[model samples]
Target chain A: MFSRDRWQEIFQTIGKNKLRTFLSGFTVALGIFIFTVLYGMGNGLKNSFNEFFMGEATNTFSINPGRTSEPYKGFKKGRAIEFRNDDIDDIKKDFALYLDEITPVISFSATARYRGESNSYSINAIAPPYGDMQKTIIMKGRYVNAHDMAGFAKNIVIGRLVEVDLFGHSESAVGKYLDVGGVMYRVVGVFQDDDGDNEERMIYMPYTTRQMLDQGTDKINEIMLTYNTDIGYAGAMAFDLSLQKYLKAKHNIAPDDQNAIYLRNMADIVQRNMMFANILQLVVVFVGIGTLIAGVIGISNIMVFVVKERTKELGIRKALGATPASVIGLVLQESIFITTIAGYVGLVLGMGILSLMGDRFKEDYFISNPGVGLNIVIMATLILVFFGVLAGYVPARKAANVKPIVALRDE
Target chain B: MIVIKDLHKSYRMGTNSLHVLKGLNLSVEEGELVAIMGSSGSGKSTLLNILGMLDEADSGEYILDGVPIRNLNETKAAKYRNKFLGFIFQSFNLINYKTAIENVALPLYYQRVNRNERQEKAMKYLEKVGLKNWAHHLPSELSGGQKQRVAIARAMAAEPKVLLADELTGALDSKTSYEIMDLIQEINDEGKTILVVTHEPDIAQMCKRIIHLKDGVIVEDSFVEQVRASSYVQ
Candidate 1:
């Protein structure tokens, strides 16, 4: 609790020792500043990494065929491998209960013609389930359906950028006819993705229509599959091992041939990335707290000096009927005042730098909005109080313990 | 009113203990102006400190204004000190940073009086001490005599029953010293009991009663002819 007299006294004392007070306050401000900047950068790194997994299911994994790296039985190294359409049927018949959605992908770069406005885009032929599984947000119309695949209809879904390039950003191109390398298809949907230009410069069509155009019957590039619920780290690893064994057995490859087939599980990547982020956040907390502790120690040292220098004044106050509690209150209040003021300065400076950085900096892996959140502000406030109390307690006790008679006698 | 019986105090100088007060007894009626005089090491300072409640006696029975003064906690002791006593120190002891009125308002601030009332009472006391025009000036801006007057105003602002002046004029020249003694005399004439601790015979002669001490015991305690401090050249 502070009165006007107490506040005036604190300010007067601080003003009397300007350099000493500034240096002490600088420690706390610097600590909080470093904390805000470092923790914000850490969050930026985490979110940037998270951008890698965006617009796709975290529990999903993809299998890609690869050349053999080892020989087993009559099979030799360097032999190319490829997936077939029958593999999708076999996987579904066997693990239909465990799988949420499974689709084979076959994409190729093609030039699209919309009334003489041509743009080059990668055209991917996928099953209907792929749109929902990959989180493709259709801005207008609809994706390819089972009827489209079964009837071999000339229906297609164009990405937002492809629409802009071909349709001039005027309106939805749904129901419009577009020729893909002389093969005409009707645009049924327009989709956007978080991956920016890369996802935008693509097109989606039915797998059956792409297979018909491939000339290699039933050939597929990769199979993407996801579970109904999140499969954690251990589960993802176990699934990877089992799937690898099943593929090797079915394709007649060597059991120990490491490169026969490759698997990339989104769940495994998510788990590893999450663990890294958690460790980074924990390190920021420790470093921030460490910086604050150093600042608190500085405050404590300055307060001890203040107590020593004010011995005579304290004695005078005591002789005038100030209780020990009031003496302690005076010391503690001064420390708290200094620390809180310093901490606020740091907070404002730190956040100002972050906002400026956010405004000017371009997006990379960290994506958008690279700054501290509400939790960090709350945490910093709590630290201010803790440091204030900790830094002032010992010196205030010393002030309270002074004997008025002896102190007054001090020269 | 004050009473003390069998008060004893000592200081430890390394392994040996030096006894300062050995079974001292004293009594003073309300409104009396007394002077305590002693040579150095006579333990008069210690006795004055005991009387002011700034130090605890090793053994003593003391009473001031009908309340027993024995091992009171710091809080209660502070309350009693604020309610019953005022002090004017030789060095003035005015908080240097505060203005004259603010320095006078310090005790009332401790008493948790509201700001407006504290300032009003402080100004009243400052006017009583004849420093109303200098109320806003800092102690550093005032002369030695003016600073003592501010300290006197601060002491009396709480309206205590008794005033203790410990060498209140020691740091001032003779002219300023006589002026401060004259002010103290006027205050005592208003029926407030007062005690002055000093070594100067002239200062001691200004009081109605004088107590002499040597080697921790009172050698002489008697009434004396009171001299008017205002009659001295200032």
Candidate 2:
């Protein structure tokens, strides 16, 4: 079936009929080209959604203190509520099965001086588990540990940008001392955050040290924790309601008060954004398939016309002792060859365009690094070529079965 | 060599059938140059089509080179046609894109001849037709006589037992017609059985035997004094 002479004959025909070959090839190429570009753009949009919504830990909740709006149990309305380190132990003990990790945050702004380079930065004094909840990536040294908290040690973990700012990119900030608000704190680590430069510009220290600096009080500004993921969405929502009620009762605030304790659940937000991204991808794939179908139709139409055009030549070949099978093989092989080559050309061109446009559309169009996987595009091309064979086969069979007498007769 | 007995053929034109060949009987021996003569609608082409295995006789006994040609499927018929008969059409019927030598090599290619031998045989045939220098030229680039010569070379390349020519000179001027007829006579001198279908009396006189047909039946069959076409060709 794979004869060099047959291939040579097909090449001669194709070379002689340039317009016919180009017409058929252009249809297939254009079809795959549109499909690749659309699929890549869809992936880019999904990437953007992921980068925006998935920057931090998804199965987490953070609660902040607010002024009470209702009076309850002798506590007057308009009373300011506060969370302390003891509340962390209470939640951990009460919800041990549902809680993965918990941390307290004491936020303050301070100007730090390291060798005369000073910058005002937000400082969060936190426990060790805060590193997991925030998904912090440590670049140098280590985070604040239990020993530092128990000893009330003045050790801090600075952000990546903070290190560059204080040390001017010439020195490692780890193990170096920086004077902040008249107190000297040794930097123990440098960390980075995917949530962009804002998270990368802050500093972290032991909460016990911060509490000691504040006259040894146990006051904390906020509480953060990640729940066990095996508890699905419904379980997480139930946990959120229960935690809210417990915090309200502990702070002596009214049950229906909305301002006493503010809570944000990352799981619910992530789920909603994920659903939107999936729907967007579905729409893109639907359009891509439509393009491929149009391409198939286009190739089918061209093949029919080509067979009609070659009726006389086919008659001559048949008269010269060409079997019906040989006639069909010639046409079918030519169709497959053109479709496969043209589809590959379209795939390569689309990928090249995507890489050249890399991240240029991210800020304006929410399409980041637009491209499709090689396996996906190749599979799509093979499907198109398969359909191309069907398209060529119908007309080829018709031409082959035509009686030479009828075919050679003047039209 | 060829034989036919009680050959019958018809065409249905939308319910009404037109009988083309009605119970025809004929025979010819090897090396005989025979001409079939008829006017339009006289079944000359239809008879030639059946003889060439391009069409089937509805009910008849037909044999070529000792092989009975009846109830044969398309593939078997194609093989028989390729191995036992050669055809020269009025319009030349060359594949326009292929060069003369490639066109000549087509039949040998179907016969499974290797490339080098197919080329060598095609070149030999082109030399026989006095067009060896035009072997690489496409049909469109050749003149009418040269194109017909290429078609003749292509038909002869397979070396079949019988050569069938259907109005082989109909599309050419008288001078070129005589030249083609002269070539046909030279081939017949090689002991190959040949049948020429034509309406022209002069073309028929060039053959050793002539069969006249009318209204789908043989009206006359007789041997005539052969006129050599080479005497008239310049």
Candidate 3:
């Protein structure tokens, strides 16, 4: 039976200030819109790079000893650096923590033959841990074992295309012998590459055997090394200067060589991804929180104007048995009521806008189907209530403090 | 009942102070219909406001219901007014936004009366004042006399000990003025103390006693027989 005519009066006041309320809601909606979109896009970009790099050798560093801008060993600025097996041995000795397994890759095209099938394919002479350094995703069977390298085992793993072109299936290639340059080598393992294709062309042989049989003792094109530790940054930094200096001394080159073996730091990609993630989160927070702050300030400013306008009516109420606390309660309730309604309006619009974009936000790297989360909505609602309380505080206090006699006597 | 002793009120503009009431002393017992007759700026409205607790005297002893209230704060004063006082303004100061019944119920609403009960009480008072047909009509829709009638209903609904009417029918013509005076006299006869501010001796003649003021001081206080031209307002 209680008449909340006071609350109805407050509703009427807010209804009269339509544009002010609209602008406040718009600020909150815009904030939520930007936050959802940016987070989705940032995650999407991150996932794309992850997809491209996922199955590749994350632990191994390829040695490219060529192409220089500054002279090494007093050679011309643009010079190609070269290395042999002895240099690889010296590097392994210097940083034992850095070198897990050293695989010497020797590749060349050759005519391979079996009993009824004959095809031309590329051949690779590899050490025992060569498959791990190649970044090949092994789908079936084992890689070359230590015994295969020590006994000079006539075992080869062919590329995907070679298996298809010769036997038409990777499973059939295993346990069969294929003549590599007319030297019959049995298949030790059938493997698939990261791209979902069989890697059958690499006719792997022992490095010692490849040297003894093929007369390639002086030629090892690349030293493929995997770190014993997964702490990439420490391994990379520790190896950079020491490896360059060791190479300079071993090759009898200048100490500060502009052209040394090319080292790729995989940690750079990880660090960039991490930093971008933080930036994306910050951008979302700023845009979203900024909108909420603007809304609160707008409501607060308009409340000040409203209090000023209704001074006379409030004075009359004061003279009519209304307590200071009751006066404050009236204004505060009105403010909270107005902001809550407006915030809900904004929340609905913001969520709707984000959902409309969710279907189109497809990308490979990050979580693409982003929508306004309930936790964020709840947080926004709490903020609005706090905003209402804060915005109404000063005006309500002023109203409560009014002296009734002076208030009523006002013209 | 209202009583005042050595009451003083002044208005300051720049360095000059204009004394509105100077050393005034008077008393009105319950059931008394007292008309305060004074010209414009003779401080009749000022005295009325002070008695109603709507303004403070610079120096005075104002005792209403045997309690001193000269220095009471706004909250206490509002409480005092709500419990014991009602007012009828010359301009019929009913809130324009409120219906006649709502206007009548304003005091009860402040006192936390139940909604339906407050409406019922408000309508009863309005019917007594012959305004029940216009219960939902706003002040803007009513004639000047009808608005005053609504004001009277509001004043009576609260059942106050004293009704202070500041120029109660000042804006009405002669006939409406007498009708309002008759209502006030009827209320006084029923044991409510009524004090009216007026410039016309004709209005003053309707009351049991008259207090005449000039230059903010009481010039005379005596009972009047009747106005020679007296007739029913209808």
Candidate 4:
């Protein structure tokens, strides 16, 4: 296949018509470039979305209280609804077998101070299961436990950023006392979240201790829950709906009052996101194929002109005892050579640009690392070869069918 | 080496059919240097085409080297054309893009000879035509006489049984024409059968025999006192 004479002939022919060859090759290269970039960008966008939901559980949902939209019994429609500790205890006791983890949360912004250095941070009071549910990484010490909550101890888990704020990085903040909201609390643990300092600006403590610190109010802000959902989307939604009804009954809200109890189904959002990603992938493939077809058409058009130009030469070859297959092979080989080389060049350039852009946009969730996989590269190579063959076929056939006598007489 | 019996050919121009070759019967034995001569539209070109196997007769028997050349497929016909017949055209129809040596090597390429062997054979033939020094030059770079010599070298490289020349000097001056004829005569002296198709009486007189055609029939077929092409001053 790498015969020197054949290669010389191909190069000579291509060299004679430099502009035509370059234009045709450029179209194929452009098509491949667009294909690689579009598909890579599509996957990158989907990856960014997945990154947002990575640390938190996919099967988890949260419940938050809202203003009653519909009255029940003697309750007014505009009445503000709020959750209590008793509701959290009842839900945990009743759904303990079905639930994976459940936690009650109450948060408020407060100042953390150790000696002279002080910085404002959000204070989160949660149960022991909160750390495991939110995938929080404990840097030192332990989180608030059942014993701490039962005894209503003033123990707090400071975020890693809060630790740095209250005490310098050289000192350990755990086992030290920090003043939070004018109350002294011992730091039980130092932890971090996936988003680095963004999540590390908050601190955690026992919910019971927070309630006592807040002047004897038993009101809880929200309840976070996760359940086993191997039974799929419909079954999970059915369980969620039943749990919503149970919450409605406990809160004395009217049945079918949708605004009274706000529920966020993270599992449903994950499923919807996966569906959108699949559709995006299909769209990229379709557009890529369309561009490839246009490139192939451009190649065929140029090949027709080339075949016409070589009519006399082909006739001379045929008279010299060249077989039809040999004549056809000449044309096909040129097309394949041009397309494969140009397509490879385009692939490399497109991927290189994407890699640079990915680094530039690293801080944004809209686009992540945009690049093609090995399978896509392999598939693109095959498609380029196929396009080469398709583009060369008609002109090659015309050259093969040329009669030596007629062609020789042609001016 | 070549035989034709009752050969007929025609052309169709829309509604009109022009019968070119009426009932031609001829044969040329081995080692014969023959020339077919006639005026324009006398069907000599058609006869040359049929004899070269570039075209088929409507109804006739054409044989070469004891093999009946009738109804052979394109592949078989091309094979026989390569092995038995070599053609030199009036315009010195060498591929313009190829260098002189590459043009000479082309037939050998189709014969599936390896690259080294083809190059060696092509160089030897170029030397025979006395154009060895100009081999690497393209056809465009060579003069009319040099181009014809390159075409002759290309034809001889295949080592075919019969060499066919169609007005081989029609595009050259009288001096260059005779010089080309001198080269053709030298090739024929080596015992290769050759057919020269021309309209010039002086050119036909240079051959050992002349067959004159008129209205698609042979009017004369006779041996002559040959005038050697080299005897003409260049």
Candidate 5:
């Protein structure tokens, strides 16, 4: 199997028949190239899906209060529902085993001024855990903590764009005093949001401070909480249903009310989007495999033609004392060599093209960082080579087993 | 040395069978230069094919160099052909892609000889055929006579016990034919057993004995006064 003589003979044949070798090699290379590119693009599409639907925490749920549309327990059908601070404590005490973090949000738009600059920014008053839920990357100082909430401290965390607008780009926004709606607040942190520019233009503060400024009201505009991930998807769904039921009952709303409360479960959206992405990837893989099969058939056709063309040469070799096994070995080894080398060439070229086009198609085509894993590409190449051997074997065996007299008789 | 007894061969042609060799019997002693001659379709080629082990006889006993050649598989037949027999065809079937030396070294390569020794032996055989300077030239670059010389060198490179030439000079001109026959005679002079198959009377006259076949059976078997091909070389 490791005969230098055999390899030398193969190289001589390949070198002498440049066109024949190139034709067969080109078929295999194109197959693998298309396969790699298709697979990488599929992965890119999945990346885009994940970024769009699952950029924030998947375990967190946001519940917003709305007007009640169904009457229950003597409440009118058009009653306006509201979430109070006591509801947060009730949910925490009831779902303590399944809850990870809880936060109440009191959002309002306010004009913030610092020295000479002023801009209207949507300000969200929340707890420390809200930073994790929103996936905020703190650039300077820190988030609103428990001590600030307890003391109702007028400390604020500004978004990146908010800092740029009111404080300008030249100076740090942290530890600076900013005026919001006639109140002076000290900026404790400056942060960035991956959810894009709109999120980066907002500001955050302690909910206790916002409530104190609201004439000591205990009302919250929205409630957000993260559930323990040890509970799987099914458990998360069940928890969502139970939490909705509990909230509706506490508000004295109808069980089947359409508009009493609204719940947005990130887990459910993430799961559905992931399913869609997987199906798309499967389709791409099938197309890739089909291309590979076409390549195998292409190489097979070329090999059959090659063997037929070399009938006379093979007869000469047999007459010179080449065994049937040696004849088969020669053709099989040549096929494997050509396929392996060509497959690698295709893989490298495809990967190079992908890297060169990295993230360029992210906005228009929803294909982010398009590329394939090395292990998968290598496996695909090996499969093609194996088929290449089969393609060569069938024809080589027929030629090898042919009698020299019959072969010589062929013109 | 070769012996064939009661050899029979047939080819199936659609619904009928054509008998090629019908119960033929022949024997050649060591160092014999024999020529088998006949018209086309007289089974001369079929006989040569059987004797060279390229085709097996339907019912026959073939013994070459004290080894029985019956019911041997492809590998054994190939080994025997490599070790005991050398063949030369009219077309001088040298692999076109290979150089003269590479073509000559092919048989040695099949014999599992090391590269250096194979090249040395191939070069020696090329020198024997008076083509040592043309050893590195491709077959396409050589003349018909030179190509036949390379083929002959390749056949002899394996050091077989017998040399079989089937119309060895058919593709050459009258002068080149005689020149090739001269080389054959020189090889036979060195005590090598050789059989030349040809229909040409002049070619037959060059051998020490001639067997004429007609319709798959021998019509005449007789000794001849050998005409040295060297005398006609000019």
Candidate 6:
């Protein structure tokens, strides 16, 4: 019956103390805002990475050679061993059934020139199957073929940045002459990468040409491989270990050799970044929870004080046939009223800030667009109600305990 | 009807015990209009507190509407008080933020009274206290007399078995006090039990019975009341 009046009183009190209430709410809002932004960033980072790693040779492995270590059947202390082209053939032929595609690469940085424009660049000498091995999106032109690779043709492919620099934004850079290290090569293809800068400073040439060009280099710089199925993650991992062991034994190398060749799977980068994001999100939630707790406690303390002020009124109500439940309800309504209004204000402000931020900023490393979906809002709402009830507990009990006589006597 | 036996109450301020009531015994029957008079520290207010269940009797028994209250817990005590008690204080004790109708509607909040019904009843009671014209006026806007009238209407709203008033006219001018006294007496005549405490003999004399206490013990009980006729008796 009196619940209406209780709520009315709650709102009235809040309306009376607008500044204090807003401050408390602001703390809570800040907590939620931090958590929401962190989580959104985590998601945004995930989105960015997903965009970056658009499915190519996802679970793949490679093997590189190392230096001689211990006495591997009478090897010298500093004897360096390496894999020849034939050794690569041996591995590929032996693992042909399991192999998706393997492309050996050899390269070095040099200047790329078109007409009068010459820009410093890295030469990426890849096998004809390197396009499939690179597993990246092509923006223009066609990829080189096995025949072109076997014949060691001067055909070339470039990244969008390189294409822009070499051909001045011309889309049909294919078949055009691009001078790499003063040698003319025909542009065959172009690619678009998320980090255009990383790609623009590179030139792709036939692996055979690059290998022959480096007279001192008997082995390729790297090998990239892909698998057709993902169930082979474990198999792929084991194979990678075995391949490393094979290379070590045949090349007679030590495990700790600084110059030892090693594999770097892009999947590992993605996994590590994701883990970083998750940990970041956890930290954000802890901060948010801390803020919520502070706000809730403030609300509780203020509610207790409010109840104390209303002691005589409660007494009078009790004496006038108000049940303890009613008294409790009255105080509870006040607490919930304050919390609901305050929390809602906080939520709106938090979400509003996030929305505004989202509108203003593009996805970046530390921040993403602000978002408060149903889940976050609903959770905050529940927290507000719970905080309200907890805050109201003592006050409600005090009101219920008021002896009509003593309450009336209270000043 | 109400019965209190051997009611003892004390407040602990640090280690010192301030005895407010010591083995006080009192009784008020149905439809009785009574006043308990005492000076400061005479425990008149304490007696009122114990009677209203705003404080507990250290070791005592009290019965209201046939139910013994010594065994009641804090919450139960409040329920008992709410079920059968109504209180009016010298300060009027009206929630200052509430409009007259809302003030009158307060006690009913605990009663789980439906909203429409409670509003209707509050309006009805406000009219009875002659504050219907200012139903929306908050206590601050009302004169002391008007505030007390609103308080009186609030006390009457729950239809409690007993109305307890402490220094009901202490803050009011003579004319307003007399008017409030008349209203209270009229309410009592309507068959509601009331127990009022005051130091003013004139105020006590308004009741059908007066109990005077000094030092927490009743010194006198009387049936003789200073009779004052109201021009608008109804």
CA lDDT scores, all candidates in order = 0.84, 0.91, 0.72, 0.86, 0.92, 0.72
- Chain A vs native chain A, TM-score per candidate: 0.87, 0.92, 0.62, 0.84, 0.98, 0.74
| Candidate 5 Cα errors over 4 Å, as ranges | none
The candidate scoring highest on DockQ is 5
Model 1 residue A373 lDDT? 85
- Please write out the lDDT profile of model 3 over residues B1-234, one tens digit for every residue: 678999999999799999999999999888888899988889988888788787889997999889888677756777787788887877776766678998888788777787888899999999988899999887899999899999899888878888888788889998888887777776776898989888887888888899999999999999777453236754
Question: Tens-digit lDDT track for model 6 on B34-111?
Answer: 989878889887777777776667888888889887766766775676578777878887776668998888778667
Deviating ranges (above 4 Å) for candidate 1: A2-27, A69-80, A115-120, A169-172, A213-216, A362-368
Candidate 3 C-alpha lDDT tens digits along A1-411: 124777665565556556655654454444444444554444455444465556556666666676556655556776666767776777777777777777777666688877677877666777767777666645445677788777877777766666666777534777778887867888766676764443545556666667667764756767777776665677666775676677667765666665655665545555566576667766766766776676567666767766765566676566555667767777777666656665666566656665675636454334545555667776776686687577667887787677654555555
What residue runs in model 3 are displaced by over 4 Å at the alpha carbon? Answer: A1-255, A269-297, A359-392, A399-411, B91-100, B133-150, B170-182, B199-205, B225-233
lDDT of 2: 0.91
Top candidate on TM-score is 5
Query: Please, what are the lDDT tens digits per residue for candidate 5 over residues A1-411?
Result: 788888899999999999989988998898899889988988888888888864488999999999888778998898999999999999999999889999999999999999999989999999899999988999899988999999999999999999988877899999889999889999999999889999999889999999999999999999999999999899899999999999999999899997989999999988888899999999988988898889888888988888888888888888889899988888888888988999999999889888888999998999999989999999989988888888788888899888887887787
How far does residue A217 in candidate 1 sit from its true spot (Å)?
2.4
Clashes of 6: 14
Tell me the interface RMSD of model 1, in angstroms. 1.7
Per-residue lDDT value at B122 in model 6: 97
lDDT of 6 by residue, A76-161 (tens): 66565565677678678866666677777676888887878888888777776666655656777777677777787888878888
Q: Report how far off residue B145 is in candidate 1 (Å).
A: 0.7
* Candidate 1 local Cα displacement, residue B103, angstroms: 1.8
Comparing 3 and 6 on DockQ, the stronger one:
6
- A214-316, model 2: which lDDT tens digit per residue? 9989999999999999999998999999999999888888999999899998988888989999999999999989998999889889999998988888888
RMSD of each: 2.9, 2.3, 7.0, 3.1, 1.3, 5.2
- The DockQ assigned to candidate 2 is 0.66
Ranking by DockQ: 5, 2, 4, 1, 6, 3
